[model samples]
Target: MRDVSTLVSKTDELTYKVPVGLKRVPWIETLLLSSEPSIRSIEDTVKLEKAFHDASLFAVKEGYRRLAALNVPAVRPGDFLAETLRDDRTMAKVKAKLADEAARIKAVEDRKRVQAEKKFAKKGANKQQKKKFQQTPEDDDLKNLKTLEQRKDGGYSGKAPKSKAPKSKAPQSKGGRGPGGPKGGKGTKRSDGGKGGVRKSLFKKTSGGGKSSRGKASGRRFKAFFLA
Candidate 1:
């Protein structure tokens, strides 16, 4: 993704900038080489320098585009062609600094790419080894079957001893005492039996019934009649 984006950016830069810059170069060169008396003046010299600078920038942009097309290491604007414009000291310094930065960035990206590839390779190798280790139980059964057939063809009367799988112990009841404990043996009651040997009710009704005033009076009158 990164490579593709960089290529796109370089392509756009070349498309827009290269043609105009190249056209100005020959025109600028002719003016600089002119024998006209006005060409040597300070004003014309400055204009000529500006023209040369622009043309150099264009050349550098083209170089970057070409490098990208050829799959060469990329160059930034800061690392543009310095030797082309001998009079521009600023471009030279900017180019040097950008070049160093670009180199550092490239080195870091290359290291990251290498590390990612190695990690994927290691993962693939581990998957292959795990697959090799995972032999099906059926393979062992097939070997045993072949051995049995060979024995029968040889007229051997004795049978091979069969290998038995170890039996798993049944899960113990959660509410009952385990194994040889007194409560677990024979007819002994389980832990659910209370200390008094009486079974507790699963639910009990609460007292404090709401007796109405009429019901209370009727009960007292009934008691009084019974006493008489």
Candidate 2:
């Protein structure tokens, strides 16, 4: 088999002399023939692609260099007359496909942007709601403080009436006796069996005497009864 490097050198030598339309076919045929045996896997396909890329770069550089040496512009001017390989109808179809692809990509980007905005907006709204809820208690406390200050300064007149403390019942002994002792009976004995019993009897005796003289008379009777 012919060496790939030798074929490359020969193709390069012929590049300057060959017509533009015919210059590319020889190099393409040469690459295909050189790699035919090894082009069995994806890796070989990638290598072929790399070779084509390098060849294209080399062709572009050589073409520009040649044009520069000949005092010719490398890029065709807008007004320059030339025939294209594709007909106008084919070019129109290609342009339409390219425009459709561009529109599809832009639509995808716009959808993604709208979705992102909605997601972030929802998060922001949730944050604001949380902040409002968190501040509610503090706001109520401030209002209560302001009302209290207004009442203290006599600026507020709609104050609630003070609640009265409930009246407490007098404490009684466990035996159901009052502070004075047991209720009336004929010299009733007290549970303590102390001077409290005598004092209770004396109170009962004097309680019925409305006049001071009657009370004194009852007191003398009590003294005599006790002595007896």
Candidate 3:
């Protein structure tokens, strides 16, 4: 759940010198933006130029020591990004190269975020021509629901999914609409009976053209007296 940590001091440089920072440098990314002269594989040396572009990071003796043992060829800036993403070893390096967070919880959180970004980048590269997966409000709700389910399964006693929801995979009422509507569109209603319906109130309806009543209106026409 967290990065188990201890306090660090000047004497801890060898252990406390966390890995390199992963902030993207635009200038370094230029070579990667190109398709020509691409990096053929993950360990491409040419692409190391981008990593070492600042000299300070690349010049680190530790960096050279690690790079020298790698089997991949040199990569271009663009190629480096593309390859590092799919490589698990590189992903570990990525997490290692993060800034220090005073709290152990924050450091662990930062690691998770960087890992997710790398996963996203690798997925993107795998399908160069496919549409990007954009997050939406619906996805937010779905993620929340999944999280809740996991929490509950782990000996967690909390509110359950509303009892009104049928045990079956039957569709249930959605938005404000009736069972009769377009097959599927903005508000696709569902039903406990399996077939979905537009969500609507039962006891509320029209009473007639011009005339109206409170409890349950039977017949009516769309005109002036249609109070909101």
TM-score of 3: 0.13
Question: Which candidate order results from sorting by lDDT in descending order?
Answer: 2, 1, 3
Residue lDDT tens for model 3, 1-228: 543453344336543232368445432223223223434565754355344444444334433454455542443376665644247776566455432223576878899999999999998896764534555689889988887877767854665566585565434345333344444333343444422232233323445545356322442223212321
Predicted structure 3: clash tally: 18
Q: Which stretches of candidate 1 lie over 4 Å from their true place?
A: 1-89, 141-228
lDDT (C-alpha, whole model) for all candidates:
0.57, 0.62, 0.48
lDDT of 2 by residue, 1-228 (tens): 879999999998876454476735543233232222333455453355446557656666766665687676668568543464556786567567667767999999999999999999999999999988888777999998999889888899795569899998644434223345455323334566543344444444445556457767677657745642
Kindly report which residue pairs in candidate 2 clash with one another: none
User: Mind sharing the TM-score for model 1?
Assistant: 0.26
TM-score of every candidate relative to the true structure: 0.26, 0.36, 0.13
Give the better candidate number (2 or 3) by lDDT: 2
Could you tell me which residue pairs clash in candidate 1? none
Candidate 1 lDDT tens digits, 1-228: 369988988898765333464654433222233222233445554456556656656665766665676667864567555544464676666567667767999999999999999999999999999987896889889987888898879865777678898998643433333335445333224476432121121111225664447656566556533432
After superposing candidate 2, which stretches have Cα over 4 Å from the reference? 1-64, 67-82, 135-139, 147-228
Estimate the overall C-alpha local distance difference test score of candidate 1: 0.57
Clashing residue pair totals per candidate (backbone < 3 A): 0, 0, 18
